[model samples]
Target: MFKLDEAKLQAVLKQLHQAIYNHERWHNDLIRTIICQQPHDHHDMAKDAHRRCRFGQWYYNDVPTEVRDHQAFLAIRTEHKHMHQLATQLLATAATKAAIAPHDYDAFANALDRLRLEIQTLSREIEESLYNHDPLTGALNRIGMLTSLRALHELVKRQVQQCCIAIMDLDHFKVINDSYGHAVGDKVLSASVRYLMDHLRPYDKVFRYGGEEFLISLPSTDLKAGHTMIERIREELGKPPLAFHGSKPIPLTVSFGLAMLDPEVNVEETIRRADKALYAAKSAGRNCSRKWDAVNSTPLA
Candidate 1:
């Protein structure tokens, strides 16, 4: 599943390079038309000219919805549209054999420059996101996890917001790895993380804490809400056994240990509490969620 995501990022980078080349060709064509004092029959003169260009066709029709919804992509769309509108004005003037105003040409040039910047920004963002994520599962790795959790911890200390962390472990993952080959185990891990990510809210963060385990960060959530959220995901994973290569479907179940961010201690201590709760869940039969009770230093299912 994440392989597809990685491929999409690579494809987007390739397409972005092509987009620059396409725009350059279009710009050169416009320059040639101005120099020859001739108006060519080109789609660049249309009000919706951005939608007619080769790059625009790919962007509007082929790009993923998630990529299209990005801030940099949105900026690129705005700049592209604005540039085309200016180009249409310039083309109309040139067709009448009239001199093009300096300001008009400058506006088009500026828009083109801005569009290129936005494309570069989008490319950089995609690369960074891919870098931060675990190659096996698309969930974020531990690279920046501590720093992020610490920041969230400070907010909790300030009473600005509530945050919870859950440590989730796949039940008997080693059995799957031993029963099937590691390849199949890898497949299960990938599929499970993908499913978990799909069910989570956009703002929530999931980290690949270690093999067969994940850490879920639920921002602006208390212990109860975190338990509810983790429980829902736990139930979802129990059904719909994973299918592979037309063989028997492999059943999957996950146990979760939920704990609120403890303002009184370091984030690591909080993680320890969650880990203890996870241990409690495992001991009390897997496939369920348990929450840490700070007062009793115990976990409750």
Candidate 2:
């Protein structure tokens, strides 16, 4: 029988619910505490009231939300931006050397009430999105990627069409992490994904295939076309050296192994062949693309 890890899911839900509740409660309490002690030296406290709530950072930075719910993702992100704006306003109010402004308090209170409700809405959406995405770089995770590949595989079987899978790996990725630190390595990984996403056709998809690698599927593409597409991606990615957080820019390169879908073979076999080609690319020299050799495989297999 097919079963998801229900207990694990429930634990995650409980944690998220508690996080939202605690953030809402704590922010309100802080507001009340600051407003009460407003006779002297209270302005500074009021100004920093918003900074006291760490829930948003905890949810975004600590908690992983790889769900595919775009609406939920956008809603939560919007709320996060607004929360910062409101907090900054409160801080500025405290910093000002004047009597407490009635308008400011009313505005802050109304916004806080809206945020209290927004958190619940965001939690619901985040739950839906988590099911089909990668929490780290926001790409479709392996499972999600497999689902789409399955559909494409079926299409290849039923109709006369071209398909190819390109297995791409970051060359010297561990060295990148060791030389620059893991944080830069992470940025590079995410940046590589962005480049693929930007260059790929609308129907094409690139899935995270564990670690600094991805499996990009191109529907309606022959080996020639797929090669061209991936080469373009390589050209774009290798250039414009990635600059992390205003530090000196570092160059990143990738090697690709490509295999065309064979009508007589299964998708997995084609992937295996593609992976072989990828290894060849890296072996030849990093940062080049190689195609699977079908002629050799026919005799070996």
Worst 10 contiguous positions by lDDT, candidate 2: 1-10
How far out, in Å, is residue 61 in model 1? 4.2
TM-scores for candidates 1 onward, in order: 0.83, 0.57
Off by over 4 Å in 2: 1-129, 298-301
Per-residue CA lDDT of candidate 1, range 1-301, in tens?
Answer: 1234777788876887787788789888888988898767578777678999887887789887778777777888888888889888888899888888999999988988888888788778777667888888888889878988999999999999999999989999999889888999988998898888888887788898999999989999999888888888889874687536357888888899989898898999999999999999999989888899998988998
Displacement of the residue 147 alpha carbon in candidate 2, Å: 3.1
Query: Which candidate leads in lDDT?
Result: 1
**Worst 10 contiguous positions by lDDT, candidate 1:** 1-10
lDDT of 2 by residue, 19-96 (tens): 777776766655664566333223224433333356654655554444323344445555555654665566555546
